[model samples]
Target: MIKLTLLLLFFIIFIKKNICWSDEPHMIVSAIAYYNLNDKEKRILNKIFLNYKEDRDFNDPITGALWADHIKSNEHSTVNPSDIRRYEILDIFNEWHFVQIPYNPTKMFLPHYYLNAHKGKYNAMGVLKYIYKILIQVQKKPRHGTYFSYNFYLRFFIHIFADIHQPLHTISFYNEHFPNGDKGGSDITLNYHGQIGKLHHLCDNIFYSRKKHWPHINPSILQKEAHVLMNMYPPEHFGSKLTIPSNKIDFIDSIANESHQLAIEHIYSHIPVRLVNKDMQIKVDQHFVINLKGILNKQMVLAGYRLSLYLKDIIANIPEDL
Candidate 1:
């Protein structure tokens, strides 16, 4: 009975969360981490990455991170059918990029079970760990599947790590008004600068436009930006919450929880609560932009730094014999 109620409730509030940051934001993350990788690590990644590279310009962390997103093409929609990556044709695996932790996950029964049970399939945290299992299989043998080889999974490794850091991606608020959760914030609308838009869309909007290409910033600038923020909020800033990681899974969950905490304390707190209707129209105060910028900049930097460490750990450990 409880499971049925929760499932029914979920469908009622199911709004797809926008990609927390756009393609360029994801690119920024990979690019920063790529800067920190050693020459040998770069060489290894370079070799594996060659499988997906089409143009000579495809050899950078930004490009590599963008690789996962580039699979999506309106090419097929154009006058001439454009070349689509083989994998995109198979499955986008969109749901693997995030998990909507309820306002109070500990208090919810079915939601908690669904989270643990469907981590790999339905949650970004599970898929992040699942990459390791796939890597182990790749190291042992090849041709397990034609399309999804080690390189293919590497694309997800680059993308999903960055995805989890976006606060909206990691959480949703549930309450009397939103019995099924706030649909990861998409179900709520805010009025900003005379325009009304979904709150999640606004949080995820990093660049000025929606064009598929990256922002016009240089890679060096992004790396420096990422470097600066990583130092600003080091491990010391994180409380016992981040310090007590018992295993690999725990570490990722810790990060997710961190993201959730921010969604509540930093992101959602600014909005006037009574003003938040099913699709509330809100005008943010002048300080809201300042706070949002600070939050986003910090998350992006941490995303890059942690992504680098995690990716390096996996790539560095892949057996030489394989």
Candidate 2:
């Protein structure tokens, strides 16, 4: 009964759009990652997820990829009241989704107020490193206990891998106009197709869709999109970018820096600067939209490939008994 209720709640909430890549793109990323695995790797993944097949929250990688985001919903608080401590921990670390890496192209002087607001805080990069270690430990020793289950860590691993790939999530721009920062472009208002919207939200909904299939995803749509993306941008398409770093920490930092650099060169450079502080909005044009979509598309593909490669390594390290 509880699972049914949560499923209904997810459908209702997902009907509206989300602020980051929406659920569709996340699902597509998971699907792409799964499809990238070999036959044996797929079987191992299936075995690991067998315990969660019936659970609405993480029945599959596609659903699991959205678990991190779904927890933000009010309904999630009531799903498992028995785990108060766990819920509390999650609430405290709820802001782990993004890391505010500063970006100042002109190096204009500004107050030190917003520069290090997120410094020393637990961000996506930190969470990912911690979770990756937990995963390896759990696989090495089946009895390696944790505050959260292996599935919990696995789902978060999948979700954060995709989240950090978003350019806006890894960077925030600072300048003279808005001395502080734009809160990862959330404060930048723009006229998108005659509608006033935040720049961050617009970027988040790059692959936006209003199709509502309650309590379940349209598998055809998900698989087709994933397949198309893999074909369109294969691993070789990324060239040297596909080569991951040797150290895990370096690997995570590389991902964050890649997205941050892309935001500076591609995103901030193309968009018009908002001069007026009043009702003026940056009018979005086709050229800008096209360019933004292209960058986002490649990011999504690269994230999926990286996710698949990481999972493959994890599975290889796991003991057969696990």
lDDT of 2 at 74: 40
Candidate 1 lDDT by residue in tens digits, 172-263: 66555665667677778765445456777656654122213453456666666656656786645644533434355468877888888888
Which number leads on lDDT? 2
C-alpha local distance difference test of each model: 0.62, 0.69
Can you give the TM-score per candidate against the true fold?
A: 0.73, 0.80
Model 2 lDDT tens row, 1-322: 9756634432322122234556767887888899888999887666666666434455566767877766664443323535431332335556688887888766777557456644543888888888777566555565454323656777778888898898988887776676677767777766644556666766676623322221356878778888888889989999988888766655888888889888888777765544523245776665666688788878888999999988887767565655
> What C-alpha root-mean-square deviation, in Å, does candidate 2 show against the real structure?
8.0
Model 2, residue 141: displacement in angstroms?
2.5
lDDT of 2: 0.69
Q: How much is 196 displaced in model 1, in angstroms? A: 2.7
